[model samples]
Target: MNSLALKGNPGDGERMAIMSGRHQAFGLWGLLLLIVMAHGCAPGGSTEVGPRAPVPPVSAVGLAPDEPLRVVATTSIVADVVRNVGGDAIALTQLMPLGADPHAFESTPQDAGVISDAHVVFINGVGLEVFMDRLLASAGGNTPVVTVSDGIRLLAFAGEHADDEALADEDHGEDDPHVWFDPNNVKVWVANIESALSELDPDRATTYRENAQAYLAELDALDGWIREAVTVIPEDRRGLVIDHSVFTYFAHAYGFEQVGTITTGGSTLSQPSAREMAALQEAIVDHGVRAIFVSTTVNPRMAEQLARDTGIQVVPIYTGSLSDASGPAGTYLAFMRYDVGRIVEALR
Candidate 1:
């Protein structure tokens, strides 16, 4: 069409210009609206998801005939319990390497691949696996996960600032994750593992049950042994000073008091302030703590310094991960035995 003629009243021309400008503005706004709608096609047409939601727990599904149930465990400790229950019926992959600190674990692309291929993943869940959310996202977010510590009650961090039960958060972030320190908790782990395996491979349910029963018996025996062994330490001298709050369950189960921790909180990822260190040193002297128990996975620089400052020994224990099969703490059972024996010797 020909352009509209401008030979009109001046006022009329000005009005037409205003109308044309309005049309252009409306066109721009319409284009922007379409772009926003395109991007906002998520549920409820909301574009922003804010923070990522935690990976939800998935249920295990039974495998086909004679097919091995593929399993991935977050740590070597968790893998050992699953190994005890699943036996030879499942193909297991442990994500964190041996002796790696679980609180500071970083997942790799290969770990994501291993997780993605698994039928079920086992974890010592109470905010223990810090890399789990991103790792699960990388693994397509659909892998079944069994938290071995599900049924057992979690102990919260008895920080200097708060009481134990008072520190329990809605997310249980302050709760302790080192439940395997107590053999009874490991019995719960064995039961959870057996149930998950039985659901995943029902044909071998009998075998899983049998293995779980045997392991439970072993755990009971270990529990009895720990009770008897801790008796060697005089009641008045049973105070524990550790690198961090990793031994709450151990203390609670074995009648020892966690006199002090170098780190201020449950996580070793946290740093101890100068004030906190001074206070811990004072507590050590006040409580007559004999040694500073440190985890093999954690750096002993601070613990060594603390030991020097306090004139006590630094006892290295396995907390986060297990050692190789040839090592002293290769298995969970052996790990507890080694740690307890060291604790007894240090405190007795």
Candidate 2:
């Protein structure tokens, strides 16, 4: 996929057009109405996510004018952000397909080829793409790359994760890479994306700016709505027990308490020891936590075990990727809606 920009032909426009429009519409009407009313439907839905390994951005510098910007996203969540902001101006290849975990993902030679040839690449940054250093070390792309979450107020992850080998990769000091958990942070993603795309392909600047403005407004509305919805939960109930330390940004943004996690690492590559699980279960019971939120991309077995042992309910929601076009979380906006609604539901 060393093509610059992406090939605009969606293989099937009728399907893709409907998919695109519907995905765009997923939360617009309600979110718009919510902006006025200070409310919107709570999070609800799921989506498929990204690939197995990190690939270098494949540059397609000499492709035809009709060829869209060849962009490679480290994760599907990042891909959706670029798509919403870049619109039809670029062709994006998600290095990690839906459902693949980024924290533990490995990069292959082919993946490196994809990274090396892109005209512009969007990464979540904040050490999220642990494979990035090696990928860049290999000189994967001539494509200009930018981190969408570059200027975000990255959250500090003090908890433990599952992947130790990748732990060294997150030497990002204290900044958290899971900024998408906070809509405001994702708004930063829009800006970085729009700036990169506009600069990379000046011809599409108008489109990129226009889309970014609109998407950014939506993000703001989402943040406001979250503030409103979260108000419904009592302070004591405004706490979360998650599988990994994935919700630090989300919790921080929404005024929720991070009581702790079943696993202590930044990634889910590790398993909780019997003692760790017992401790987390005790924590849940101690806090009277109503729910344990687990990302849909991962099995909730550990969470379920903890929930059962601690008498907490496990709620499944989209954390990484949007669902297939047929499901509720078919896009980034929907992914947020799905998650926030679930959180609102269990807590309220």
Candidate 3:
């Protein structure tokens, strides 16, 4: 992955000169450089010479006539949100593949290429993308990286999650990154995405705003549906036992307590000690948690073992990434519905 910064105000002649020099030094690699350079030279391309420029609104940036804005999202879930806002106005690429765990995802060279060519990048930022710093370093460019969770109230790690070794190892501070668990929070994401997309392609500002408004309505409906579905389960039985602290936002929003987890942290990469497992099992039995919700992105062996020991069912849920096109939880809306329905079925 090339780590060259591509955000300068170079004229076309200077760009051609740079491309020619690159071609002489590196063969086909220079062609890739040229493509990236061409993207940077597009309308709204960074024109600053030294220090990074303040992030400009999409309206401030100019796009070439008929040129689609180039965008990149760190995960499938984020990609879907951007897709809803940008619609066909932007060429978007998802860095993480479907079903990839965002917590532990490492960007490939191809991903770096995509990021390098992007005019803007969207992420679920609350320390969720552990590889983000390194990935950004590798895909060095002045592409504005937007954190969709920017203004949403963040939930701090508490209770049993406070002592998690993985959270400590990753230095995730106190805030949880699984904000998408609540549709209301995703509404915040939709607004941020629309704002960024409009800033990048102001000509499509109306279109982006319209798309965001429609998606926000869908998210509102999803929130109400989740509330209604959750009510079927008795309040006392609304405890959630999961593979990780992935449901903190969901539990908070839908009036459920996150009783315990197979792993001790917010990330699936965390492993539980024997003491942790014993404690989790005890909590499961004591709290009468009927199901252990396991994420499709993580190995379910530990969760299955816990369920077997506790005599409870192991329910699979989508987290970190969306299901493939042929799967039930393919889109963000479908993913939430599927997971909420599963939760209702398990405890109701």
TM-score of 1: 0.81
> Given candidate 2, what's the lDDT at residue 104?
54
How would you encode candidate 3's per-residue C-alpha lDDT over 1-348 as one tens digit per residue?
Answer: 111122222111011000011112323233433333211113232212333334322334667889999989888999998999889988988888998877656678877778778888887877677566556667774566787887889886433545555445654445667899999999998988887777667888899999999999999999998988888899899889888778889999989999887654445544454555666677788888899998998777777767887899999999889999799999999999999999998999
Summarize candidate 1's per-residue lDDT along 13-36 as a digit string, tens digits: 010000011111234234433333
Better of 1 and 2 by lDDT: 1
lDDT of 2 at 275: 46
Better of 1 and 2 by TM-score: 1
Cα lDDT computed for each candidate against the true fold: 0.72, 0.65, 0.72
| TM-score of each candidate structure, all chains considered together | 0.81, 0.76, 0.80
Clash totals, every prediction: 0, 51, 3
Residue 41 displacement (Å), model 3: 39
Query: Tens-digit lDDT track for model 2 on 1-348?
Result: 322222221111011000011112223233433333211112111111223233333322455668788888888889988889888778888888777667556678788888777776677765566566666546543445676776676556633232224444644344555678888888888887887676667777799999999998998888888788778888889778887667888887778877767545455544444444555555577778899988776667667756776677899887766788788888887888888889889998
Model 1: lDDT to the true structure: 0.72
